[model samples]
Target: MAEKPTLRWGILATGMISSWFVADLSLDRQDAQANHVIQAIGSSSLEKGKAFVAEHLPGKSPTVYGSYEELYADPEVDIIYIGTPHSFHKQNCLDAIRHGKNVLCEKAFALTAPEACEVLDAAREKGVFIMEAMWTRFFPIVRALQQKLHEEKAIGAVHRAFCDFSFDMKIPSLGPASRLKNPALGAGTLLDIGIYSLTWTILGLEPPLGPAPARAAPEKTPKVVAAQSLDDGVDVATTIVLLYEDGRQGIATAHATVKSQRDFARIEGSEGTVIVEGDAAAVPSSFIVKKLDGEEKRYDFPRPGRGFYWEADAVALDIAAGRKENAIMPWAETLRVMEIMDETRRQGGARFPVDKD
Candidate 1:
């Protein structure tokens, strides 16, 4: 067996998401593909970064950089896992790429499709690997579901998919300039949680066919129709419908202010419908397959960590093989998803300030 090449990761921000991801690496669990290391922590202050490292990357000491520039300049870092705010992704990835670090950026790769393109184009030109960290795409259950629905034809011609990712994040109390409601910060339910709904839709309707850069083959962007309820200029509730050329459709709903029942997603097909149950859409635990002929089966995937490690391993796998992108979540696919969100925001009239500028 070829020795797995370790990918040294430089975490871009010290946030809850970043903590979850870093802690996943240190968890001694079933997954032994321990091929990635947290080399550095970057934050607005060295003290904050050091605190984060001590809290999450426990038992191991890594260099803490006061600024992202310091982390980017470090030769020990091989790749960057960007857990910064949505508005910061483009600039962060650009900086990381300029320093020749591969990137696995947080979802909603940018505030808009154009920004995502800007980052992707730079990565392509620099010959460095980069991908949107849509970690759900790398989850064990999702992987098994993809093979079953697409390859095995278990569902037999999927017609539509429906997913909802909502939480009582209390947007009303978060203040206008707070990260949840601030337009300049790329704040909205669509980008925050709707992205996951839309992700599941794409997974069901348009499973990517391996990593394809630009100039490979162009397909029409998904037709998006959406509606949003605004809360002080931010989307508090949003529903988006994604339509494929083949008439397949998906409805993804998200809400930010009010509490809603945590729902399981369903994909309807000719033969059966697959339902995924999750506390949050991003972390699904099990799925039930119910066939039209009255047969049913349940597939459960208990996560070992916060379920971020799989994608981290995937990043290492791609970089080790000298690949520029991940087949599971390709660059073109990220742009397409971002474009879909842009369209949804446009149609829903939920424009961020960044969009106006």
Candidate 2:
């Protein structure tokens, strides 16, 4: 039997995303290739940290630190999971890396591409693993789709791709200082939900060029011609056209304050179309291939743990193998996606304070 390993994770925030990530840790069958244990909770308030454990991480007594710095200093923590708001990602990641801890940061990797590049460089200098938690890319269903569309050529000669990720977030009534509405906190549909639509674009439309981390900066970045409608200094809805160097085009849409039920990401080519369907378009549970000859095939991948554990497990496995970055969603991929979104926001007049920096 292969030696099963366990990785200790320190959570940086007590937010909803943090809860989801830790909850999935339990769903993982412990026997295995890798396992995750909650080592610590680093929140602004120790009381809040303890409260989070009482609720989200019940029965698992993790060290509750009143500050993130304390959590970073923990000798037992193998990796840090940064679930702080989008605005704090760069700083959170850098802090964790400076402490020599590996990291899994929840996406939008950073408020800007430069920020992403800076943090990636820091992690590289520190020689620790770092990955943007584009959790969907780790899903078996998405992996199967990628293999079919790219390797098997299930969709031949792809020409166009379309994706939409939106929901009724009710941002208008929320406090201006709230993370969801505050530009200071990197709030916007583009940086938050729009990433999902753009991720599908990169995964489905871009040439299956195989994820090769540039180590330096990426050579080619996609061109984003886009527009958006902002509400109270934040993008509420946006539309984008991604033009790839190889002449592939993707049409994507994102909405933060609108109600959308029929959300899907699909790619079309000469051979057929691959359609991804789920309540949330980002982490889909199933996919289908529709051929022009009227042949339709469907695939279903049951997500026993709400689809978050795969990425966490992947992080543990990669670390065990001594890899610094994940091939599926490499640092270059995160940087490229950030650049596109940054430019898209610039075109749409939804610039944040971070943009001026």
Candidate 3:
């Protein structure tokens, strides 16, 4: 048997996601085959970084840095995991790449496709690994669904797909004052939570065509129908129609106000329909599929922790194997999502000050 390669990881940003990731990594220590280790954590303040290391990481005593630059420069760190806010992803990733470190940046990779492209180009030139932390794509259930869709033909030629994710922020007003309401931070339901729904659409929809276009092949192009925004600069709500040349359509919606009982994706075809309950980006405990023959099937997947450990494991394996990115969350897919998001913001009139100039 091949021995697992040990990978030393540097964590950038000490936010909620970073905390969760640290806890998950620590738990991975129990597995003898797991090859990842958190070597250091960098926060805006030394106090915060030290506190995080104390509280979550305990006696491991990983180095703590007051700034990301210090973390990137740490020779012991093999890769950098970015957990900064959406607005800072591009710059954070570029810095890590410049320092010759591999990166696994959190979702909403960047506010714009152009920014995402820049990061990807930098990673390519440096010959280092870089991937969007779209953890859901690495989930067991999601992988199972992808296989089922292809093998069973449960949803034939997916004619339409609908996905929605909504949560009540309970904000009193819509203004630039609140980060949730601020456009400058790239804050919005779409970027924060809607990206999950978008993942479902992207997964169900196959890649666009190029030289070869089969008769029943997935569409070569997609066009957005409309995008709506609330009074705030952020997109409190948005509905996007992804059109395929093959006459297939994927509909996605995201809203900040009001809660959704079930945030899932429904893919319909001529033969049957599959209902993915829970956020596809964040897999739930179970899912169900309904067939045209009046039959219903259910699938359940339960894992230890918040199910984020899988992505961490994937990152460790990839870095140890000297890979540039996760095949599931490729740089191209990240760019495509960012492009769609940029267009959605433009059509909805939710422009950030940075974008204005």
Candidate 4:
């Protein structure tokens, strides 16, 4: 049997998302195709870094750094996982790329498409692998559903998709400087949660999805129209409609005032419709397909440790193969989605400090 590839990870933040990613990496899954080693941790201070290790990664002795610079300079680290807020993603990715380290940055990839372009350009110049950590796209259940819809044509000729990623965030109660309400932190329903709704829209509408057709970037960009309700300059609710070149349409809505139902997304086609169910859009676990003939089928996936390990494993495999980007979640795709958000925010009247000219 061939030996499994191992990727050494340098964690760049000591937050909840980072903890979940590291914990998933630490799980001993017999079916995992690659090995993920938490090589180091970089936090704002030594105390916080040490506390993160003790609590989330107990019994593992990864070198901890008090500063990001120290972590970036470490020679033993193979890749840096940027779990910081969206506002910091561009700089974090640039710093890691400057150090010639691979990166898996959390989404929304940046405050806008232009910012995402800079990061991707830097990685391309540096010849290091980098991918936006849209982990939900790598879920086994999502993959199976896509295969059924797009490959098998289970839902023949998709016409429209509706997706919602709403939850009661109680935005009014948060302080002005809170991450949920602060524009400086890239706070907005469109960027924070609406991106998932857009993801579902794209997944349901785009066909033959394997790195969109060559030189079709212009044709692939959807026509976007949107509206947003703001709370002290932060978007509290948003609705975006994407019109495709082929006449298909997708409706994506997000808000902070109500919890979304378990079946948060529906893709309707000529022959049938697919209903997606999950705790949230970010952790989709199952789907049901209902045909016009009254036949129905359901698919369920067992999620372990937030299901982040799938993307981590893909990163390891990509790096092992000397690739600078992933086919599943490539740079172009990241930019494509970021462009959708950019247009959505533009039409919706949501602007951040970084977006200022």
Candidate 5:
């Protein structure tokens, strides 16, 4: 029998997302072949960390730490998963990388493009693996969509696309200011949900065209087209437009107050359209493809392990292979998404405390 690749994981934070991840990891363990294991959990308080472990992980006993620094220093831990809020991602990730530990950070990867770049640079210098935990990109449905777009050209020429995600958090009524509405925590609809809407755009559009034709004609460098943001101060809602060189346009919108039934996405082209129904952020259950020829195809994707094991599998495969990151959610792609979000915030006037002109 081949030896199982052992991946010792240390979790930072004990929030809702962290609980979900731990639950998924435990569920994966039922399969004897699973390679990942939780070794420790660190929270701001030792008692809280212990309670998290006791409540979430019943049988398996994992170490609990009062501070993240101790988790970073633990020799037994091979990788650390950061579940901290968006604003803390930069510092937490940097500290983990500096300690020579691989990291899997939850999205939005960081508060700003510059902060994300700093983490990328540190990962490169330290030779440590780091990845944004954009689990959707690792799912079977998303993979299938990518292949369909590239191989079948299901939506020929990719003329335009629209995606939306919204839910009513009822922030003002929820007293105590949940992180969802707290500006200090980098909370808003854009960074929280807009990132998912933007994923479709990124997947469809190729990189921007080189310098504009006119500027190059004079043998001078062209001015870079900076991204535009909504500038609302707090992004309760946001709309982003992405333009491609081939005349393709992508529209993504998100809101915290409204309830969008499908959390849908549609891609239109010269030949046909592809409609994905269900929360794109979650593992989608079904999709439909309609051709110009009046033919229709429907697809139903099976849910596996609460829709998180696929990402866990990707992490295990990459780590065991000694790879620095998953190609599916490459560091470059993550940086691009952050850049877009930063610009969106700037346009929306959604400024975090750390964002200085």
Candidate 6:
């Protein structure tokens, strides 16, 4: 057997998400498909970058930079991870792509579908690997359940699915400038948590694996109906209903004011139902398959580090294989989900700073 490929990562932000991702990469998982090395950390200030490295990585001695451009220009970096706010994703991705860098950008890929298109188009032109970091889709639990439901036809013909991601964010206590309350930063339940809910619904309804079926025309895409509750011009809660052409329905929801149940999602089929439960929709760990014939099966996954390594491992393998996009979370899927949120926000009246641009 040969050694796994190594991918040097340049982390572009020192936020909470970046810390979690780096921690996962630092773990010593024997089953990892590839080796991940933290080559550098980029921050607004040199001191901040150094602090992040010291705090999150401890003894690791990765290079720290005061600016993003330096990290992008570093030849040692095989890829750049963008953990910036939603509003900054488009520009951040474009800048990295311009530098000929592969990218793993966090979800809510952009503030709008067109912005997402611009970034993806740049990556395609650059001929580099680029994917939205919707890490949930890469989880072992999600993969197993998806295969069981779609590939094996475990639940028979699927008809409807519902998913929700909600938490008591204590929005009232947050200042106007806080990312959770500031419209300028793209603060909203839809983009933040609702995207996960929408992702689960899509997973339950669409078969991502197996041989490609005949491409459905644009008109075949589900019709989106949505509603939102606003607090001081920011959406605090949102609900979306996707009506498919064949009469199948997918319901997705998110909220900032209340917590959701452990069983946050369900996929109903002709013979059985799949009940998904997780600490959060974004970090699903287990699920149960209950059939009409009285057969029940359950599955759980080991989560050593918030489950970020699954996506990172997949990304490294893709880069090593010279693929320009991920098969599981492909650019088309990212754009489709972004468009769904775009329409959802449009109908929900949740406007961010990017709308004016």
> Where in model 5 is the C-alpha error above 4 Å?
1-4, 29-34, 175-177, 206-232
91-199, model 5: which lDDT tens digit per residue?
A: 9999999999999999999999899999999999999999999887766777677667656788676688778877886766654456776777888888888888888
Encode model 6's per-residue lDDT on 1-357: one tens digit a residue: 977999999999999999999999999997999999999999999998999998999989999999999999999998999999898999999999999999999988998999999999999999999999999988988879888988899999999999999999888999987878898888999989999999899889877643224433323569999999999889999999999988889999999989999999999999999999999899887899999999998887767878899999999988898888887888888898999998998899999877852
Candidate 6: where are CA atoms >4 Å away?
209-219
lDDT string for model 4 (63-162, tens) is: 9999999999999999999988889999999999999999999989999999999999999999999999999888888778888888899989899999
What would the per-residue lDDT of candidate 3 be over residues 148-181, giving only the tens digit for each residue? 7756667676688887777787655655565576
TM-score of each: 0.95, 0.95, 0.91, 0.97, 0.89, 0.96
Clash pairs, candidate 1, are none
lDDT of 2 by residue, 1-357 (tens): 667578999999999999988898867464335777999999999999999999998778999999999999999999999999888999999999999999999999899999999999999999999999999888888778878887788878888889999988889889888888998998888888889888888778654445445443443766789999988878889899988788888988998866545438889999999888887876697888999888999898876767788888788989998999998888878888888888898899887787773
Q: What stretches of model 4 exceed 4 Å from their correct place? A: 211-219
Tell me how far the alpha carbon of residue 334 in candidate 2 is from the true structure, in angstroms, after superposition. Answer: 0.9
CA deviation > 4 Å runs, candidate 3: 28-33, 173-178, 207-219, 279-281
Report lDDT (CA) for all predictions.
Answer: 0.85, 0.86, 0.78, 0.90, 0.78, 0.91
- For model 2, the stretches where C-alpha displacement exceeds 4 angstroms are 28-32, 207-219
Stretches of candidate 1 off by over 4 Å are 211-219, 258-263
What shift in Å separates residue 230 of candidate 2 from its native position after superposition? 1.1
**Tens-digit lDDT track of model 1 for 270-322:** 99999888788899888888999989998988877688888888888888888
